[model samples]
Target: MTAAPHVPVNLADRLSRFSDLWSQKTVAGVNDYEVKIAKLKGEFVWHRHEDTDELFLVISGRLTIRLRDGDVVLEPGELFVVPRGAEHCPVADEETAILLLEPAGTLNTGDAGGPLTKAAEPLD
Candidate 1:
């Protein structure tokens, strides 16, 4: 197989390649972590990554991460980090695009696997 060429991972461009909710496409990587783009809608399952922290950066629309304590609402250009072992559920009022930074192979549903869980797929 040929190696992928280095290029910019345009958020809008990468996102347009898929339409499934909760779908995640790996765009790039740094060290042990991978930069992923996901298009989310509705409510995601309540899950937690036992061994890795998950970072969410909102690129478009609004995202609300519901924790046991409260809901963290993120708008465009906003970001939040959910620490390891913290159970949380993500909700989107509308179609939302987000960039996720987490360890490679980290499951989208984390410890709680169900129908929404998906294996990360590389964009290129």
Candidate 2:
């Protein structure tokens, strides 16, 4: 089915539909990329997307993108882009909401597939 024309997707309402950490829900699409939202907590695996960069925008709480060189910390309303092929891990001390922009079907775990790897599901 197609979405209704001219009706904007509400991010907060979409986010409220789920509470599972580390699982991404597709909110919208931009060409070949998907705009996804996820609730994150604790530490994630070190992984790298060899072909596409990943953009992370924090909507609530704080997130730290840990890299080999250093860590990039982001607060609410902040964002960071992890360059392609760069090994990085995401860590959040508490529950954090984030929006991600990446190629459609990109695995959450990237090259380091594990139990945390989740396929993006469209928001209901």
Candidate 3:
């Protein structure tokens, strides 16, 4: 038997070209779900996606997801999903690398925080 061909992804490779707070890099796409890597810092504006919900998995560092009433702190091995139409904010104490899975066109942030919230698009 033979193993599947694969490429190694180093942290430097994934994050070297991306430094923007919400800058994203497309890793892979399988059907309706898209996998992406994002570099996050500071605090993200509170918002929500009107359509499909969002999924997040931390690769390194720590992340905090703030909801309308409370927030959840996520470590490197944890995951979180914010339901559609629910306002939330993502904040990081330090630079954090995270993998996200969501339907195409799903915004990284949400709509509740006014104009700063961004609509989903290619990072590079």
Candidate 4:
């Protein structure tokens, strides 16, 4: 059997290239899952996708996931999962870069409001 083509992503390079809040690119995928890199700043919209759970991995800086019940802050090399149907909003004090892994078609913003409503942008 042959191996799939593999490429190493320079996380620092990607972060430096994209400074916009919530700019994403699709890296790779298989079946129903996909990997994405997103640069986030300020506060994101409050919303949730009922069909899929989202995984947030902090690549640099820090990220805070705000929820109705509580919130979680993720530092570099840290990660968290916001389960399906849970209301959440992501916020970064300065600039934050994260790798999001989830099923395809997961919405960036959940069901609430305040801008940031779009499908995941492929960041490869």
Per TM-score, the best of the predicted structures is 2
Task: Give per-residue lDDT, candidate 2, residue 27.
Answer: 83
Clashes per model (N, Cα, C within 3 A): 0, 0, 3, 8
> Model 3, 35-114: lDDT tens per residue?
77888989988777888778889988999999988989999989999888888889999999998888866656545645
* Candidate 4 C-alpha lDDT tens digits along 18-85: 66677566676767787888888898777887878899999988999999999999999999999889
Question: Where does model 4 exceed 4 Å of error?
Answer: 1-4, 112-114
Candidate 2 TM-score to native: 0.96
The ten-residue window of minimal lDDT in model 3 covers 1-10
Model 2 lDDT-worst window of ten: 1-10
By TM-score, the better pick of 1 and 3 is 1
Report model 3's TM-score to 2 decimal places: 0.79
Better of 2 and 3 by TM-score: 2
* Residue 59, model 3, lDDT: 83
Residue pairs clashing in model 1 are: none
Compare candidates 2 and 3 on lDDT and give the better one: 2
Candidate lDDT scores, in order, read: 0.91, 0.93, 0.76, 0.79
Q: What tens-digit string does per-residue lDDT give for candidate 1 at 11-50?
A: 8887888998888888888987899898898999999999
Candidate number with greatest lDDT = 2
**TM-score for each model:** 0.94, 0.96, 0.79, 0.85
